[model samples]
Target: MSAVIALRAPLDEDLTAFVQSLRSLGVAHRVAEQGNEQVLWVPDEQVAAQVRELYARAPQGDPGLQPAHTSAQRARPGFLAQAKHSPLTLLVLALTLLVALLTWGGDNYDAGRWLSFVDFHIDGQYIYFGSFAQVIDSGQWWRLLTPMLLHFGLLHLAMNSLWYWELGRRIEARQGALMLLLLTLWFGLAANVAQYVYGGPALFGGLSGVLYGLLGHCWLFQWLAPNAAYRLPRGVLVSMLIWLLICMTGVFELLQFGAIANAAHVGGLIAGCLTGLLGGLLARRLQRR
Candidate 1:
């Protein structure tokens, strides 16, 4: 038999710590559900005594003890909460779908040319030098802004969307959606322009560069404030860099695969890290005053 303990107030952070303590004490238990309320299951025999001891020392508002079953469904991250707090992340997702539609429709529909208004491309033999001239001659400076929203294929779109959704939400929450959007634009455009000059033509496209920027922004923000409310573990930073390397892995297998804008990836990753660090510094400097 098992007994449930319902905490009156939510236990979000100290949960793992408390659970570890229970294990060390030779107590058998399991977390039944998570939400505004958390249900802790303990053996029926030990429930009464533990309840008494916990009640004496527990913080105010804690229910201390209740009967709950293991069969109860656990709580999941609420979709509503996510939308209410980070609506921009949701908006970005919608725009991503629109981009996919434009990609497919543009090739098939006569209206596709309109979509190309923002797409960036390299020209001629010089993969590095050509893109800049094209950017300048094309007079589509807005391509720097719109390029972050474009994708090459279904697979490319899906992967980029997944990353945007996952990372964008947390970042938007911490820095606000407007700021993240600005950073993405700055890094994406700057990286695209830089790579065009360095990578030398061969035509390029995609949002991987801006994604790299977001990755760097998140990493530096966390690094600068290790003890801050949204601290990220060191592993996350390493993982971001590793992920960037994997994104560039396409360069090595270029012969087997179709043309890839790896230069944009490298450039974007570099730009993102630097921009993120700069943004963090700017924020801190402002906060100090």
Candidate 2:
């Protein structure tokens, strides 16, 4: 895996000379544009040190090398690059959006009935059996995961999707797609079960649980692996924690923000923290060995 060491948009001639120097030194490297900046990535930290040394020794206007393509002329990596870097995150985002679209506007859709993990009744008659019971009775195991795909409204979908993208991508980038997938499933199951246990047999669904899980995972992983890139800004952590506290206080319902899944959030955070703690400890032990 490569680590980005420098982020600078060098002049055409300078970039050409730099690339030539790297090639001559047999250092593997790549250039990628992130937002408005061009990033220079080297596969090894040792190679990055050599690159820094070369830059320091070379003259500013060395006329030995020909001009290369400008940074603007280089093609910018798009969605495919993003997906490649964070496939699990993008896949989850796509599935969530598709489910949101399919179940839009209508509250009585069969999709929701099949996805939610709770049983609900009307007038003393069972309208739909609980997902957990159905899985045991009918072998429809997908119900455990489908709950995380359901969203109630546009605002709900937008907020959850935004957080998922922001947090999920970080985990996927730093950890791996497999880790992200496992964490999502684990968090989804724990959160859905917690919500069901706490408020039983009702309509509730969103990725807020998974979001909290990602939040906790990143929060703790950064503490354990300071050199790892899985860091969250302090402001983001504080704001989210404050919001969680506010939601738990039943303020959202009072202000007409609708019902808050306080149990799911708490359960997800706990599960994520545990997972992160274990992962961090394991990572540290491995590094020591």
Candidate 3:
């Protein structure tokens, strides 16, 4: 690759967006640190002028550079677009919906008994049986992560699913599906364990905790790696935090919003923040190297 342009130190949002544009165009490029500045490199000299033009035009709000789609590109269907953009997110959405459908509006559907990590009470004392024991004893290890798939109502499912799609797609698009899956499992497990610890064997389940984790991850990741595409608007961050505070204050319960898993939310946020911080530091280090 050859250096196309030397962008100024501390790259701005426009430049980062331009980089993403170049990537979307399938341009092979790399960002290399050069003393006090960073240079954008393209592999082909023939495309140097094109890259330069795009970079110049990007800041001026002309990002609609749609490349011609070939017969091969047009051969695939529209749903493929979602798969390509965020397959993991779509899969989770489908699974969550399926679980909700199976457990919703059915007199025999005991979501709490089936999905909660611990659903047993012995002599008025709640005993916690986590995934480890469940796996060893009953081989039902999915108990650890299944709580995230259980939603109390349509509103709960809709809100969590929307946020998961929004946040999960960004992470999967930037970091890949594997990272999203790992983060989901980590946040889900941590949140479930936290809720179980805080509220005992009571029924509590939802993806809100994992959603909070994604929020924190995106917020911190963007702060540490400004060039990253995982950008979250200030309003979103504020609204989510406000909701968290409200839940902690038991206002949701007072308003008949059902039981809010406040501890799970806290746990998920903490896990996501730590993950984001580490991810950012690692990305910065790799960039420097």
Candidate 4:
């Protein structure tokens, strides 16, 4: 069914992400070959007109397809579509995945050393982690935050990544990328600090603490402001809290499971909840205004 909707010369590689948008929308169309440039083809003229209208109204850059006005026309965006709107969240996910790759799912200590909470020296398969004070004295302030990027295993990385992808994008969507990045750094620092304080130079890392922070933030923010962005189900937040309590009880450690950074989780959760409370209040005031 030849249905060329419109053509714009020279579609570039950037359109790859935009293609995900069409897929998410169930558009049932494809971009023509390079010779046809940005031409779109669909099954029939009606959908072609819809595409034309969407393309015509957009200002620039992949037709700037905004969310549909009606619920029926909208589809919950796929991964790429979400990534397009939430670049900061996508970047965190990418970095976590990249670090996992570099560390060989947390087994390659030598490779993952630099990404840890503290700088370290290795001698005879034994790692000597540096002190936090030393890191501060050396002006290596990044160490304070880098620990959240380290995952001890694939499961560690995957679980943290899933939650972060779900929650980080919520913050990025609601508060903007800059705000999301800043909050992430803030939560990461809290998590790292608490882990260092409790575990004391042990090899520990993961985004779980930051995930808890995000969960807490969304929990309290929605509680206070009732915005759709932070509207998570009550059961989800309760389950996370229950899990945290279970971790704190040391059952996992006793069962030969890996060490759980309870302090980091608590610290990050406190920080996130505080931020949520303050941010929610501000949002409510603004809404009133």
Report the number of the highest-lDDT candidate.
Answer: 4
lDDT of 3: 0.76
Candidate 4 structure quality by residue, lDDT tens digits, 175-280: 8999889889999999889888888997788898898889888887877766556878778888999999999999999999878899999989998998999998
Cα-based lDDT for every prediction: 0.59, 0.75, 0.76, 0.78
Worst 10 residues of 2 by lDDT: 59-68
At residue 155, what lDDT does model 1 achieve?
A: 84
Clashes of 3: 0
Q: Which pairs clash in the backbone of model 2?
A: none
Best by TM-score: 3
TM-scores vs. true structure, each candidate: 0.62, 0.72, 0.75, 0.73
Write the residue-wise lDDT of candidate 3 on 1-289 in tens digits: 5445534445433355556566667888788555324677776667877777666766432346533564334333365686678888999999998888887822223554577675443344554444445544986677778888888788889999999988998899879999999999999998998997788666678899999999889888778766535767789999999989988999878989677899999999999999999998877667666
Which residue pairs collide, candidate 3?
none
The alpha-carbon lDDT assigned to residue 186 of candidate 4 equals 91
Question: How many residue pairs of model 1 clash at the backbone?
Answer: 12
State which candidate, 2 or 3, has the greater lDDT. 3
Sort the predicted structures by lDDT, highest score first: 4, 3, 2, 1
TM-score of model 3 relative to the true fold? 0.75
